[model samples]
Target: MPTKSLTHPVRTRASRGDIAVLYTVHLDTSHPTTGCDVSPAAVHEEYVVTRVTSVAADGAVTSVQDTRWSYDNSSRSLQDIPGVAKIFVIPQDRVDVEAALATAGAHTYPDTTVLRPYATMDEVCDAINPHRH
Candidate 1:
Protein backbone atom coordinates (compact mmCIF):
# COMPACT_ATOMS: atom_id res chain seq x y z
CA MET A 1 0.00 0.00 0.00
CA PRO A 2 1.10 3.54 -0.77
CA THR A 3 1.71 5.74 2.23
CA LYS A 4 0.52 9.31 2.19
CA SER A 5 2.76 12.22 3.07
CA LEU A 6 1.74 15.82 3.58
CA THR A 7 2.33 16.51 -0.10
CA HIS A 8 1.38 13.28 -1.92
CA PRO A 9 1.45 9.50 -1.78
CA VAL A 10 4.85 7.84 -1.85
CA ARG A 11 5.16 4.21 -2.80
CA THR A 12 8.28 2.12 -2.34
CA ARG A 13 7.69 -0.62 -4.87
CA ALA A 14 9.86 -3.19 -6.59
CA SER A 15 10.30 -2.91 -10.35
CA ARG A 16 10.75 -5.41 -13.18
CA GLY A 17 13.98 -7.45 -13.00
CA ASP A 18 14.32 -6.58 -9.34
CA ILE A 19 15.17 -9.60 -7.18
CA ALA A 20 13.81 -9.94 -3.65
CA VAL A 21 14.88 -12.09 -0.70
CA LEU A 22 12.37 -13.92 1.38
CA TYR A 23 12.78 -15.47 4.84
CA THR A 24 10.09 -17.88 3.83
CA VAL A 25 8.11 -20.32 5.94
CA HIS A 26 7.11 -23.27 3.84
CA LEU A 27 6.81 -27.07 4.06
CA ASP A 28 10.08 -28.77 4.88
CA THR A 29 10.01 -31.11 1.94
CA SER A 30 13.79 -31.04 1.58
CA HIS A 31 14.58 -30.50 5.27
CA PRO A 32 17.75 -28.62 4.38
CA THR A 33 18.17 -27.15 7.85
CA THR A 34 18.85 -28.93 11.10
CA GLY A 35 15.83 -27.30 12.73
CA CYS A 36 13.43 -28.60 10.09
CA ASP A 37 11.28 -31.68 10.66
CA VAL A 38 11.51 -34.70 8.37
CA SER A 39 7.82 -35.47 8.31
CA PRO A 40 5.49 -34.52 5.47
CA ALA A 41 3.72 -32.02 7.73
CA ALA A 42 6.95 -30.33 8.66
CA VAL A 43 7.46 -26.56 8.61
CA HIS A 44 10.48 -25.06 6.92
CA GLU A 45 11.94 -21.58 6.97
CA GLU A 46 14.77 -20.18 4.89
CA TYR A 47 15.96 -17.31 2.74
CA VAL A 48 14.91 -17.43 -0.93
CA VAL A 49 14.31 -14.99 -3.78
CA THR A 50 11.96 -14.20 -6.65
CA ARG A 51 12.37 -11.85 -9.58
CA VAL A 52 9.84 -9.07 -10.05
CA THR A 53 8.26 -9.33 -13.48
CA SER A 54 5.82 -6.43 -13.17
CA VAL A 55 4.19 -3.76 -11.03
CA ALA A 56 0.66 -2.46 -10.82
CA ALA A 57 -0.48 1.02 -11.89
CA ASP A 58 -0.89 1.90 -8.20
CA GLY A 59 2.75 0.86 -7.69
CA ALA A 60 1.79 -2.27 -5.85
CA VAL A 61 4.09 -5.30 -6.24
CA THR A 62 1.46 -7.93 -5.72
CA SER A 63 3.02 -10.70 -7.79
CA VAL A 64 6.31 -11.86 -9.20
CA GLN A 65 7.80 -14.51 -11.51
CA ASP A 66 10.86 -16.69 -11.27
CA THR A 67 12.35 -18.89 -13.94
CA ARG A 68 14.09 -22.21 -13.63
CA TRP A 69 16.17 -23.60 -16.45
CA SER A 70 16.47 -27.23 -17.42
CA TYR A 71 18.45 -29.01 -20.08
CA ASP A 72 16.30 -30.08 -23.01
CA ASN A 73 17.46 -33.26 -24.76
CA SER A 74 14.45 -34.57 -26.71
CA SER A 75 13.37 -31.82 -29.12
CA ARG A 76 16.59 -29.85 -28.70
CA SER A 77 20.13 -31.18 -28.93
CA LEU A 78 21.71 -28.85 -26.36
CA GLN A 79 19.49 -26.05 -25.18
CA ASP A 80 18.25 -24.57 -21.91
CA ILE A 81 14.52 -24.75 -21.27
CA PRO A 82 13.06 -22.07 -19.05
CA GLY A 83 10.21 -22.79 -16.68
CA VAL A 84 8.42 -19.76 -15.30
CA ALA A 85 6.36 -19.56 -12.18
CA LYS A 86 4.16 -16.67 -11.10
CA ILE A 87 3.96 -16.14 -7.35
CA PHE A 88 1.35 -14.14 -5.46
CA VAL A 89 2.47 -12.08 -2.51
CA ILE A 90 0.11 -10.99 0.21
CA PRO A 91 -0.49 -7.36 1.25
CA GLN A 92 1.35 -7.33 4.60
CA ASP A 93 3.86 -10.18 4.56
CA ARG A 94 6.61 -7.85 5.73
CA VAL A 95 9.67 -9.80 6.87
CA ASP A 96 11.88 -6.81 7.53
CA VAL A 97 13.36 -7.56 4.07
CA GLU A 98 15.94 -4.96 4.99
CA ALA A 99 18.00 -5.55 1.83
CA ALA A 100 21.06 -3.49 2.54
CA LEU A 101 24.28 -5.32 1.52
CA ALA A 102 22.73 -6.96 4.30
CA THR A 103 22.39 -8.80 7.49
CA ALA A 104 20.22 -10.80 5.08
CA GLY A 105 22.35 -13.00 2.77
CA ALA A 106 24.88 -10.82 0.94
CA HIS A 107 27.93 -12.93 1.66
CA THR A 108 26.11 -16.15 0.91
CA TYR A 109 24.72 -15.00 -2.43
CA PRO A 110 26.53 -11.97 -3.80
CA ASP A 111 24.63 -12.30 -7.07
CA THR A 112 21.38 -12.04 -5.17
CA THR A 113 22.57 -8.95 -3.32
CA VAL A 114 21.57 -6.75 -6.23
CA LEU A 115 18.04 -7.99 -5.71
CA ARG A 116 16.96 -5.28 -3.32
CA PRO A 117 14.35 -2.74 -4.28
CA TYR A 118 16.05 0.48 -5.32
CA ALA A 119 14.01 2.95 -3.34
CA THR A 120 16.14 6.01 -4.09
CA MET A 121 18.11 7.34 -7.03
CA ASP A 122 21.34 7.25 -5.04
CA GLU A 123 20.65 3.72 -3.91
CA VAL A 124 19.96 2.64 -7.46
CA CYS A 125 23.23 4.15 -8.65
CA ASP A 126 25.15 2.71 -5.75
CA ALA A 127 23.74 -0.77 -6.23
CA ILE A 128 24.46 -0.61 -9.94
CA ASN A 129 28.02 0.60 -9.28
CA PRO A 130 29.14 -0.27 -5.78
CA HIS A 131 32.71 0.97 -6.30
CA ARG A 132 31.58 4.58 -6.93
CA HIS A 133 32.69 6.50 -3.88
Candidate 2:
Protein backbone atom coordinates (compact mmCIF):
# COMPACT_ATOMS: atom_id res chain seq x y z
CA MET A 1 0.00 0.00 0.00
CA PRO A 2 1.18 3.52 -0.80
CA THR A 3 1.86 5.70 2.21
CA LYS A 4 0.77 8.85 0.38
CA SER A 5 -2.50 9.44 -1.46
CA LEU A 6 -3.45 11.85 -4.20
CA THR A 7 -4.81 14.95 -2.51
CA HIS A 8 -4.26 18.43 -3.90
CA PRO A 9 -3.35 19.62 -7.39
CA VAL A 10 -1.34 22.58 -8.63
CA ARG A 11 -2.97 25.34 -10.61
CA THR A 12 -1.10 27.53 -13.06
CA ARG A 13 -3.02 30.66 -12.13
CA ALA A 14 -4.62 32.06 -9.00
CA SER A 15 -8.24 33.09 -8.61
CA ARG A 16 -9.57 36.18 -10.37
CA GLY A 17 -9.53 38.32 -7.23
CA ASP A 18 -7.43 37.32 -4.27
CA ILE A 19 -5.18 39.19 -1.88
CA ALA A 20 -2.01 37.61 -0.58
CA VAL A 21 0.77 38.66 1.74
CA LEU A 22 4.11 37.18 0.76
CA TYR A 23 6.78 36.70 3.43
CA THR A 24 10.50 35.98 3.34
CA VAL A 25 13.45 36.03 5.76
CA HIS A 26 17.10 36.92 5.24
CA LEU A 27 19.64 34.72 7.03
CA ASP A 28 23.12 35.97 7.89
CA THR A 29 25.31 34.50 10.63
CA SER A 30 28.75 35.95 9.92
CA HIS A 31 28.70 38.32 12.89
CA PRO A 32 31.80 38.17 15.07
CA THR A 33 31.63 38.47 18.88
CA THR A 34 34.98 37.63 20.46
CA GLY A 35 36.07 40.96 21.82
CA CYS A 36 36.10 42.04 25.48
CA ASP A 37 37.35 45.58 25.12
CA VAL A 38 34.08 47.35 24.68
CA SER A 39 31.79 47.86 27.68
CA PRO A 40 28.82 45.91 26.17
CA ALA A 41 30.76 44.00 23.53
CA ALA A 42 29.63 45.18 20.09
CA VAL A 43 28.90 41.78 18.68
CA HIS A 44 27.48 41.07 15.25
CA GLU A 45 23.91 39.79 14.97
CA GLU A 46 21.54 38.41 12.29
CA TYR A 47 18.39 40.17 11.08
CA VAL A 48 15.04 38.73 10.00
CA VAL A 49 12.93 41.07 7.90
CA THR A 50 9.11 40.98 8.21
CA ARG A 51 7.46 43.11 5.57
CA VAL A 52 3.77 43.54 4.81
CA THR A 53 2.10 43.70 1.43
CA SER A 54 1.31 46.97 -0.30
CA VAL A 55 -2.34 47.67 0.47
CA ALA A 56 -4.22 47.54 -2.82
CA ALA A 57 -6.59 50.39 -2.13
CA ASP A 58 -7.98 50.31 -5.65
CA GLY A 59 -8.59 46.59 -5.51
CA ALA A 60 -6.32 45.94 -8.46
CA VAL A 61 -6.06 42.42 -9.74
CA THR A 62 -2.58 41.09 -9.06
CA SER A 63 -1.23 38.51 -11.42
CA VAL A 64 2.15 37.07 -12.37
CA GLN A 65 1.90 38.43 -15.91
CA ASP A 66 1.91 42.10 -14.80
CA THR A 67 3.43 41.82 -11.30
CA ARG A 68 6.72 42.95 -12.84
CA TRP A 69 5.61 46.46 -11.87
CA SER A 70 4.29 45.69 -8.41
CA TYR A 71 5.91 45.10 -5.02
CA ASP A 72 4.73 41.47 -5.06
CA ASN A 73 6.31 40.54 -8.37
CA SER A 74 8.49 37.76 -7.08
CA SER A 75 7.39 34.34 -8.34
CA ARG A 76 8.88 32.71 -5.27
CA SER A 77 6.30 30.65 -3.48
CA LEU A 78 5.81 31.74 0.14
CA GLN A 79 3.51 28.78 0.62
CA ASP A 80 3.03 25.16 -0.49
CA ILE A 81 6.52 23.84 0.15
CA PRO A 82 8.50 21.71 2.55
CA GLY A 83 9.20 23.25 5.98
CA VAL A 84 7.00 26.19 5.04
CA ALA A 85 4.24 24.98 7.32
CA LYS A 86 6.42 25.75 10.29
CA ILE A 87 6.66 29.42 9.34
CA PHE A 88 3.93 31.88 10.26
CA VAL A 89 3.35 35.58 9.61
CA ILE A 90 2.71 37.66 12.66
CA PRO A 91 -0.16 40.14 12.92
CA GLN A 92 -0.09 43.41 11.00
CA ASP A 93 1.46 45.57 13.65
CA ARG A 94 4.61 47.59 13.00
CA VAL A 95 5.07 48.48 16.65
CA ASP A 96 4.92 44.85 17.68
CA VAL A 97 7.34 43.95 14.92
CA GLU A 98 9.78 46.66 15.93
CA ALA A 99 9.61 45.59 19.54
CA ALA A 100 10.16 41.98 18.57
CA LEU A 101 13.08 42.95 16.38
CA ALA A 102 14.47 45.13 19.13
CA THR A 103 14.45 42.13 21.44
CA ALA A 104 15.97 39.94 18.73
CA GLY A 105 18.14 42.67 17.18
CA ALA A 106 16.39 42.21 13.85
CA HIS A 107 14.48 44.33 11.37
CA THR A 108 12.14 44.24 8.40
CA TYR A 109 12.63 45.76 4.93
CA PRO A 110 9.35 45.16 3.13
CA ASP A 111 9.34 47.26 0.00
CA THR A 112 12.97 48.31 -0.23
CA THR A 113 14.51 45.10 1.03
CA VAL A 114 13.58 41.72 -0.41
CA LEU A 115 11.22 42.92 -3.16
CA ARG A 116 11.16 45.85 -5.59
CA PRO A 117 8.29 48.21 -6.43
CA TYR A 118 7.13 48.73 -9.98
CA ALA A 119 4.35 50.66 -11.76
CA THR A 120 1.85 52.09 -9.30
CA MET A 121 -1.87 52.50 -9.96
CA ASP A 122 -1.49 56.21 -10.48
CA GLU A 123 1.15 55.68 -13.10
CA VAL A 124 -0.91 53.04 -14.86
CA CYS A 125 -3.98 55.24 -14.91
CA ASP A 126 -2.03 58.30 -16.03
CA ALA A 127 -0.60 56.37 -18.94
CA ILE A 128 -3.99 55.11 -20.06
CA ASN A 129 -6.16 58.08 -19.10
CA PRO A 130 -4.22 60.60 -21.18
CA HIS A 131 -4.38 58.46 -24.30
CA ARG A 132 -8.19 58.12 -24.21
CA HIS A 133 -8.45 61.84 -24.97
* Sequence-dependent TM-score of model 2: 0.20
Cα lDDT of model 1 by residue, 1-133, tens digit:
4422212111266554444433334554555545533564465434334434456786545444322211231121111212212222322222222242233124333455343332233332233232211
| Top candidate (lDDT) | 1
Model 2: lowest-lDDT 10 consecutive positions:
3-12
lDDT tens digits, residue span 13-77, model 2: 22322222222232223534444433233432221222333223443212221132334534333
Residue 53 in candidate 2, Cα distance off native in Å = 3.7
Question: lDDT per model, in order?
Answer: 0.34, 0.27
